[model samples]
Target: MGLLDLFIASTIPVLKVLLITALGTFLALDRVDILREDARKHVNNVVFYVFNPALVASKLAETVTYESIVKLWFMPLNILITFIIGSILGWILVQFTRPPPHIRGLIVGCCAAGNLGNMFLIMIPAVCKEKGSPFGAPDVCQSYGLAYVSFSMAIGAIYLWSYVYNIVRASAAGTTIESTRLITGQSSRESSTAELGSCTEPLLPSKEPLASEHRIDQYALPRTKQIEMEDSGNKQLLSKLLGNINWKTVFAPSTTGAIVGFMIGLIPYIRKILIGGDAPLHVIQDTASLLGDGAIPTLTLILGGNLLKGLEGSGMQKSIIVGIMVARYIALPIIGIFIVKVRLGFIPADPLYQFVLLLQFAVPPAMNMGVITQLFGAGETECSVIMLWAYALASISLTLWSTLFMFLI
Candidate 1:
């Protein structure tokens, strides 16, 4: 199919994906407000360790035949390292501007990691199949995608876990209280010497104290926390970077799942149960396909939601929407081009590598980002706006971007 045709095909799915996702999230929120918060965290844990990583390893195993393992591993390492570099570079650039730390983390994560596995996997392979690449067969697109997705999955999980853990830890520390007064009180009292922290100052005198001998009782007075003190910017950025560094936490489920799955794929004994025969891996393959379809679109809608919410606005809030539009189109893509061309010189203009790079540049901001933000107790409304904008704007951005690259480069 022609490039224009590919654009029409790939982007249309985004709308359905976006809308259903938004609807599901709202429904989920309205039904269970408090429980949803707890559920979201556990869900993140499940996706990171089990559902998501299994999806990656299984997809790779499917694509990585005897001949393709070397490039399968090596080519993706190139993309992973390049993406890391891009993430750091973008981090430094945004840091100088001194935006909120959560916003900074949002940009860094989106720039570094992406929705390639979920969003592009379905679309790009079909496009490649239609075009009939010289690599070997049309399946090269899917194979190529395996490597790309692995790189993304590895880093995306790491980044997400890190981002989330930090915020959660901080939030817990900030809000946790050891005890609260309750009914059937045993009448224990706080030591008078110990000052109780107040969220706000003591109530102002109802009547002006005009009389001599008027007494003001000293009580726990509320003090307004300065914005600077209340600001969690640096803490947010650090949590985003450092929260999930433990090796055991990062790799336990992924490693266990991978080992079991791979053993099933490799061994004749286990293969019988999963696939019914060693000759054909039908059972495992079908199961893999089921996870594959649900994972990406679910993930895409999440991206749409986050992008919808995250963009917030300019400092003054005037022209804020305009600023957001510029950030999505003018700023990010421009930087993406500079990184590909001037910053990191393309070693070779290989079509596959080019496609991978462009795909990274184009993924909309993700819902996972908003999840991370909420977990961290960071800028919610702003994250929501920006994420939504990025998600909503991705179709136009990707279409125009691909068009420009086709003509200009």
Candidate 2:
């Protein structure tokens, strides 16, 4: 397709995001104030616990199958690559920007996690319906497209909770620890003074030999005692590692929904009951899907409300915003093209699949980051500011990348 054609194809999807987001921004204004902090929180809770899961489960149960899974095995790995590469880029941005400690994770996350879920689901079908779509007939394109989006959404949620969840959580913990230290007056000056005092009082003349003898005594323990001590240490290490994992996050409601949806999709009897038009329990799927339909608009509204915070002033550095924009928009898209063209030989040569793959890299950061930030109560304002700019600029960035991606594909 020509550049003009590609640009036309790309603009529609970007406009969809823009319009909904603009509506959300409007509702959050002082006069409207429909999506105030408390209102947004309640809506976000619904999206997180209920609507998002229902959307994932209902969509996956409808479209995914054993054959589709095998055919699309490369996708999960592609997304993993996106996350890994984007994270490396995010780290680079963090190093240079040096944002506040609380917002470091937010910056990294906004760079790494694209709006994989809703964007994929929305963009693919919309593109297919267009008259100049490079993908096949609308029905066939949409059928396969929805399946691809469903799998992407499900896996993206898994990675979001598994990887991104911990980053934000750690940022929250680090902020809390620093706050506690400040409250308790544990300044660096005190630590330096203590170290200076210890250094000045030289007591090592006889102590060195005694310390060596003590180390020798520890090594001289009976073989059985040494073995027991090693085993105990190993057990303690294992326990510490296991305890570090947030099981609640690992099995987030959205993740659980994806799991159940996969089971229903892969198993024959369950599929028969839950999927298809004539199925006995198809009503359940329909109901869940109807609720799921609300997720996109509600999420966009929440995002808009959050973005309004940026207008009021978020105290985020301008350099950090520019760094994130560069990482996510300018850098990641180039990397994606290189990966898909040069590195990914195993991916099927399907245009629709290739288009979606390329789009994943070009899209803006996930809106869910805001939700996750809210859940953690750290970096909310800074995150909102970052998101506001990232998404505002997405129209131009996504359009340009989409045009290029379509031409390359």
Candidate 3:
């Protein structure tokens, strides 16, 4: 397809999201009050706990088979690479910009987690159905595209919860400690306490260092007993690490649904029960799919509501916003193209697959991060501000990169 045709084709889906998001903004206005604070919170709850999980589970169960997963093995690796590179960039931005401790996580998260789910789920099928689409046979293209999107959503959710969750949580904790110090009028000790309370250090056995006398006494123990003590210490360390992990955060409702969906899709008996027209439990899939269908619009509305804060932001820097735009929109897509081209031997030659992979690099940050920040009660305004600029820029960035991706792939 020609570049202009591709750009037009790519932009249609984004425009749809923008329209819905605009409605959200309008509803959130004081005059309308339809999507006011209480309403937005309730809607966010449904999306996070119910709608997202249903969407992920239904789509994944319908599309992902063992064979398909095997063929698509490189996708998970590609997503991991995005997070790794984005994180490195985020760290660099943090060091250079010197943002407050609480907002550092928001910056890293914006870089690391792209809006991999809703945007792709919307854009891919729309692109597939377009007359000028480069991917062949609309029906086949959509089926494969949905499968790619499902995988992207599931895997991205897993990484976001396990990795980015902790980053934001730590930031939240630090913010709380600093706030407590300020409230209690501990002006002089606040800096030292904030440093002490920072979550940068791993949860360790003790913060206190062993005295030289204690070290000398430990060396006086029998060699055999010392070895045994060291082994026991290692075991305890492993156990402590395991215990410290917040399993509830890691296995969010969406992640749990993904696991269930993978089980249903991969196992023959389960797939027979839940999938296909003839399945006895097909009604369940239909119901879930119906609910899942709500995810994109609801999410976009929340995105709009969140963007309302961007207009009256919490005094975020223009530099940080510019850095995120450059990293996510400019640098990441170049890296994605390079990786896909270099690894062509392993990556499927399907144009849709290649396009989705490249598009993954170009989309905005996940809207779910707003919900996460809300849940933690920290950085909500800052997160909103960052998302507003990133998504605003996404309209142009996604279109331009989509055109380039279509031509390259």
Candidate 4:
């Protein structure tokens, strides 16, 4: 397709994709806060066990096929490789910042799961299927599907891993950091004993009692002094780079979903849900169409969240926002070209190979990054900031680059 076709068919519609997701997410966000604590817990339970599962189940049940199964087998490999590189890249970028250990988990996790599933899966196809698309909906969806299914499964794993790591890190820091000097044998009270001189014996009891002479102890400190002290107090910074993780519980749902989905794909009856319409022969196709419907919306929500997070303003210094574009579009395409032209030795660029590049190239920055940042509580200001930058970058850069890469190679 010509550049004009590219812009008309893809870019404009993609913008709409972002708008809808941002609007939906923004609306949904306060649902977490306005609800009572117990209500929030119940909502969380429903979303995770029911809503989220339905979303996943619908996709899996609709779209199982032997071919798709084979394609998915290769999906995790890309995520594993790309995540390693992306995580290291984030770590190196934040190295001088001296973030706490939890921050590390945020960076790595965010980089681990690209927005292929939660956001891009929706945008890519929707954009491609826009009224004027060069390719029809089925063709566009198929192309996008191959890339997203694998990417999403990998993301499921990334979330569980990141979640576990953060929980463990929080617990470890809570236990080991010794914030309470009373328990660790370093209380300031211990130091005051020497200064007490003759009064030491009286003040050193198991519980320090206020003598009548020191009645001021019962009075609250003055407002000005309290405010002054509070203002001057040093805040403990949280370092989230290269964080610790817990693996077992984190990957549970995704592992369950992916394995179940894949297994279902293998069995005809199980795979029928993924496709719709006729039974037996057309069942797989019908189920796939329906379940795949979620691929875009999930990816869209993620991208919109990233965008509204302030990617537009995350200039080069604060986050390598532009660098993300370069990585997803420029760097990745170059890698694809090098591999197809040199590593693979001029083999005809097949649909399978094209699918691989499309998935890799179109995927936004890792989903784990945002979660990772939240986990460590470091980079909170700019953690989502970086993710936003990467998200916006992927919107335009990923689609064009992937399609171009396929054609060029």
Candidate with top TM-score is 2
lDDT of 1 by residue, 1-409 (tens): 3566555545554555566656645634535443244455565555554566667656644543434443334444444554555466546656555554445555555445445455656545544554423224666656675655554554445544544334334433333332233421344444422344432556576777665655432232334334433466777877876754554444544444454555554565545555533535576666765664565655543443343334334342323334445544566567656665552543345455555555555565445555555655655566566556565676677767755543333
lDDT of 4 by residue, 1-409 (tens): 5666655645664566557656634643545433332333344344334444445544554455676556455444444555555555555645644445434444444444455555545445565556644444668555645445544544454444445345435633654464454375755566666567546366456866657655553465688667755665533122233223344445545445555555655687655543445455565444444454544454345434544445335333534444444555465546545544464433333544444544553566554344334434445445556666665565677657645643453
What are the runs in model 2 whose C-alpha is more than 4 Å off? 186-232
Flag regions of model 1 displaced more than 4 Å. Answer: 1-3, 6-10, 13-16, 19-46, 72-78, 81-107, 129-140, 143-245, 252-289, 301-350, 374-380, 404-409
Each candidate: RMSD to true structure? 12.8, 4.1, 6.5, 13.8
Model 2 C-alpha lDDT per residue in residues 180-290, reported as the tens digit of each score: 888867667788788888895665574445655565446665986788879999999999999988888999988999998999999999999988799999899899999
Show the lowest summed lDDT stretch of 10 residues, model 4.
234-243
Off by over 4 Å in 3: 181-236
Residues 264-344 of candidate 3: C-alpha lDDT, one tens digit per residue:
899999999989899999999999999999998998998899889987888888899999999999999999889987884
Superposed by TM-score, candidate 1 places the C-alpha of residue 213 at a distance from the truth, in angstroms, of 59
TM-score, structure 2 vs. true: 0.90
For each candidate in turn, the TM-score is 0.59, 0.90, 0.89, 0.61
Provide the overall lDDT of each model, using Cα atoms, as 2-decimal numbers. Answer: 0.52, 0.87, 0.89, 0.50
**Stretches of candidate 4 above 4 Å error?**
24-49, 71-73, 127-185, 188-247, 272-333, 340-349, 352-356, 366-381, 399-403, 406-409
Clashing pairs in 3: none
| Model 2: worst 10 consecutive residues (lDDT sum) | 208-217
Query: Considering TM-score, where higher is better, how would the candidates rank from best to worst?
Result: 2, 3, 4, 1
